[model samples]
Target: MTMRICALLATMMLLVGCATDDPDITVKHRVPHGSTVAVVMFQDCGIPNQADCAGSGAAAGSIFIRILSQKPGLHVASLPRPVAASAPLTDDAAVAYANKKGYRYVINGEVQDYYRTGHLALHSDRVAMSVRVLSVKDGQVLVTYTYQEDSKTHFASPDDMLEDMAKQLATSIVVEPKKQRQGDFMFYKGNGG
Candidate 1:
């Protein structure tokens, strides 16, 4: 019996090794380098007046921001939690807050949806996130990116799924920089170092 079990395990390992890797898999998007980013917790975008899943959504956004800060080549700034609150929560108050923090780019976000539904005979959890970026200098929107994911897990643990979502968000923000032409005077200082 032990011999038979070993044979079965070996076969399974071989089959797994034979599986093809995905060629189209990519995470990072194209973004300029050295841009100062201000990450804020996404506000609740769900129906108002009722206590929905706002806290969880906000928590997820916070985690996503933390993960994004750890990525390479991104100049992320730290703003206070209250200062990073929702648009309606802070209103025009965010301008002063950003100026005080010396951040050029402000990221405002909203968690539109998050839910876990059971399939006919199986169970799964779905997580969705949406975020908007605004240029505080001119009040122009930079971009808005939304991410969603669904996965199945055993009853004992769902941490893996959450980690996967965080990873996806982190990958999405890792982007390449754009090039710009500079005038001679821009670099021609008296003391060129």
Candidate 2:
């Protein structure tokens, strides 16, 4: 079982690295610190030969909320799961719906790929996803990025990587802290809109 221990240790190390600076995470815009947000759940990509994750949309959204809620400055909640397997919402539609429902921001995404092969101490895992954060009031995209992590022929599972990805996502989405008032208007740095 020493091999198993080694594998687990390796996976733990990867997770530690994940929580640090992930170059894949790009923050284009930052919302207000106390914005209220909702998730529209993710839709799985029906890639040829990819693993079947029929409920992965809801799965990813749930995991995101589980982590993002722990972060300060953002109030997070999941919208009602859409009819168990409904068609995915477009970014515009999600933002409009959320705005009408009074949410300040909305999170929408799609899980492009997810697969894990092998088991025991020799598992290989990969998960690819794209996330979008939009201002519900005006449909301005605040933050967006796609992340792919593959423990190719390694010991980590996709679940561990996805959790770490969510943590990084939480970091990338905090509100823009720097604001300046010039002339008769105000603007925040890194404003995607």
Q: Write the per-residue lDDT of candidate 1 for residues 125-146, one digit (tens) a residue.
A: 5555555455667655555556
lDDT of 1: 0.54
Q: Point to the candidate with the largest lDDT.
A: 2
What lDDT does the true structure give each of the candidates? 0.54, 0.74
Q: Which ten contiguous residues of candidate 1 have the minimum total lDDT? A: 20-29
List the candidate 2 regions with Cα displacement exceeding 4 Å. 1-23, 49-51, 81-86, 121-123, 176-193
Candidate 2 backbone clash number: 1
